[model samples]
Structures are given as structure tokens and as C-alpha cells.
Target: MSTSTSSTTPLLSLRGINKSFGAVHVLKGVDLDVWPGKVTALVGDNGAGKSTLIKGIAGIYSFDSGSYSFEGQQVEVTNPKQANALGIEVVYQDLALCDNLDVVQNLYLGREATSGVILDETTMERKATETLKGLSVRTLKSVRMKVSSLSGGQRQTVAIARAVLWNSKLVILDEPTAALGVAQTEQVLQLVRRLADAGLAVILISHNMNDVIRVADNVAALYLGQMAAQVPSESLSHGQIVELITAGRSGDLGLKAPDKEVVA
Candidate 1:
């Protein structure tokens, strides 16, 4: 994957974030930073609060307590619309495209361009074509093809392209390569790299360690609800990442043992 030094300023920064459901607290003082032109992988075991945290960031659920800042400006995100208006876009694992709709139609599903009182197919198609081109995506045969007929990789590309078409600054992809074959997975991964290369802050949520290591610039491990560490991907081996996820710390981050071992 192509890489650049992490920027001094993060495109999105969350400090001391918290979330809960009734009596259950899911997130505990989580801190994360996503820099432009880089992919930050969010990894944790099941029920480790990864999903809950992203939902809070996507504005599907409001964080109980935290400071959310975008490009250095503090702000509050209470709803999905607000997040979108602020250039935050999330493409979930489901790929939420209408099977019956073609790429062009799916791309402009709710927010179609209109001229006077008629749907402007020409302009919308042009925009979709340009967006895909801008991302250097060329896997689709035609933009008019039905989504159901596209391959897994092609479908993933369409969802990402749709998000980018809306002038998104931050793109959150949830398990983007899940259920894809090796070749398809590679195609999608390349697209992901291009997203960051194009200068968009990409938050990648994946369980595949190889994929994360290959494409991510940084990895943030969450054990339970707390951040175990947010370190450079190149600095960690797979074992170290696993240790952090399971034990909450590894290497120097882990607590030191006493000089003497206790006998049972």
C-alpha cells in the first residue's frame, strides 16, 4: 500500500468518548484520531465495543460524553443528517444497494439531480462516471448495469463511489472485504488504498489481520471499551496486535511482572 507520514492534524479526532445502553456501558473514554490520506484500522474482538463506537461516530447513536472535533473545530453530531452535512459517510458491510436498481440509479437513489421538474439522468450519470474515474476505479463494465448482476468487488466499488460522489471527507467502511473471494478482496482493498491516497480519512473496520497490516497506516485496538493502543501498523507484529486485543496491552504497554513469582 502507498503511504505518507501521518499528518500533524487529524481530520477527525475523538477524546474521552463514552457510550451506553440502559445500564450497559459500551464505550469508556475512547480516544482516536483519523488523519487524511491514511487508513486507520479499528480492530477488536466481538462485543469489544467496535461497532458501538463507529455507530456513535456515524451519528446513528449519540455518544454519552466526548469531544468530537473535525479538522480542529469542535462540534456535536446528534443525527445521521448532521454527520453527512459535515462530510462523514459510512458504507456498511451490507453494501445497502437496491438489487433491482442500476449503478447510476443506486448512486443517486435518494438525492437525485433534477433539472426543472425532471430527473436529470445525463448530469447524474456524468457525475457518477467522473467520481469513479476520480477514484481510478475501472472494474465496472457499465454504470447502467444492475447492482444484483455485479460481482462482489464491483458492488463494493459502487457503494464507495457513491459515498465519494457526495463530497465526503471521511469515509467509514465496515468489513468491506467480508464474504469476498481472494481476487475480489484484492480489488476492494486496492480501492480502499486509493480512497486514502486521494486524501480522504478512511476508517477501516476489519478482522483480517493481513488486510489491516497491508493497507492500514495505523491500528487502534479496543479491549472491552477502552483503547488498548493506537500505534503505527508497521511497528506491530500480528502476535503483538492479538496480545493487545486479548490482554489489553503488549510489550512495554503491558504491566510489568514482580521480581519474584508467588508460590501456590
Candidate 2:
């Protein structure tokens, strides 16, 4: 399955991916390349296997076939720890913050600083402040503010800031703005664009077409566990994308619509 992937080596590539569970084939011969400094939006309906494919890439599930490559080298990422070490971060909609804990504490949860076994709170807090400032995050009142006091956008910002602080190579966002208002959604989208501008590969999974069209540089649609379409966002119209997602293939893809007679 040749795609729009460039001739230049990709930062991350998945080739010949196949996954199944008790006779249910989830993915078949999937190929995708995520280059640095681009947003690849993955879109699909409910149960279209988008989440499953992500799990496979994130190392939650081992696939029966396919090779996952990073920086032109083939590697097996078998678990979350390996992915994290490789600078791959997945930010789900939940944002995964501790409401009771302050921003700094949440950011450095298990990975805390220590001075002779005692946590170096002062240093960590100071570093956290620097990170937030680097991202130009303004809504955050203080590094010591409890997450429970933060708004939806603030929580999302913290999650992304954590990824940026870790120098994430590939950041996967799952429905980043599903629960946010227009302003908050814009905030997340700007953060996403910033990540790409800084040369990080971003894979965004969203059901909202508007969000996808607005933030994506390229779009990949999954239909019924099959990668139905892979096209550059600029080359496609919204109607064409919708057709590709709802149907197996769109007219622009040169595949005949289901049960439709091919024109002679």
C-alpha cells in the first residue's frame, strides 16, 4: 500500500501491519509513515479499529505481522516503557492529571528530583515553570495550583506540555478537543500546530471532521478496520473525505463505490 510518504526517510514507519482477534481481522497490510513536522489526522467512525491500531503502535498489543521502524531502523516496541524511552507519547482525551496534586507534582509524579533521597521540590517546580513558559501557556496561574482548579483547556495544555518537556518524537493525540468549547479547542489546535512547527511528528485521532480539516497537513481515514484513504489534506475536499470514510473508497481514490457499476 504505497502512500504519500516522502522518499526521504520517515521519523517513524509502520509496514505490513496485521492484527486479529479470534477470526476478526482488525488491520490488513497497513502502511504509514510519519515524518517530522507534520500532522497526520486519523479519522474513522466508531469501532473502525483506530484505537486498536494505536495500541499496536504504542506496544499495548503485539501484532502478528509488520515492522515498526524509527529513524530508518527496525525495532520492536513491546510495551509502554519502550515507547516512552523512544520518545513516543500518547495523550488521550482524559489528560491524565491528578486533580488533588499541583501542576508541578502532576508533571513529575513518579519521576521526581531528589537531593540525597529527599525530593528536590524547588528545582522541579522551577523547571516546570520554565517548561510552561516555553510553551507560552498563560492560563496556568502557578506551578503549585491544584489541577482540580484548572479548566478543560488548562488540563489539556498540561498534558501536551509534559510531552514537550520529555522531547517527544511522535505525539499521538486521541480526541484532543472532544469535550472543549470553541476557545479551548482552538487552544489545543494551536498547541498541536506548535508541536509540528517544532519538527515533531503528530498523529491526531479525531471524529470531528472540522477539527481534522483545520489542523491536519495530511489525512488518513480508516473504515471497517481497513485504511480506506490516505491523501494530502490540501488535495481533498471535505465531501471527498466524508465519502471515503463512509464508503470504502471515494471517486477521487479511483476505487468504484460499493456495488456501483464501473464506468466503461
Scored by TM-score, the top model is 1
Tens digits of per-residue lDDT for model 2, 50-149:
8988888888988789899998899998898888888899987778889999999988887898999899999999989998887778888898999999
TM-score: model 2 vs. ground truth: 0.92
**Model 1 over residues 1-264: C-alpha lDDT tens digits?**
665554679999999999989999899899999999999999999988999999988899999998999989999999999999989999999989999999999999999999999999999999999998888888888889999899999999999998999999999999999999999999999999999988899999999998999899999999889888999898999999888888888978632333696799
The lowest-lDDT stretch of 10 consecutive residues in candidate 2 is 1-10
Clashes of each: 0, 0
lDDT of 2 at 157: 91
How far is each candidate from the true structure, as Cα RMSD in Å?
Answer: 2.3, 3.9
Candidate 2 all-Cα RMSD? 3.9
Clashing pairs in 1: none
Candidate 2 accuracy as lDDT? 0.84
Compare the candidates by lDDT and give the number of the best one: 1
For candidate 1, give the lDDT. 0.91
Reference-based TM-score of each model? 0.95, 0.92
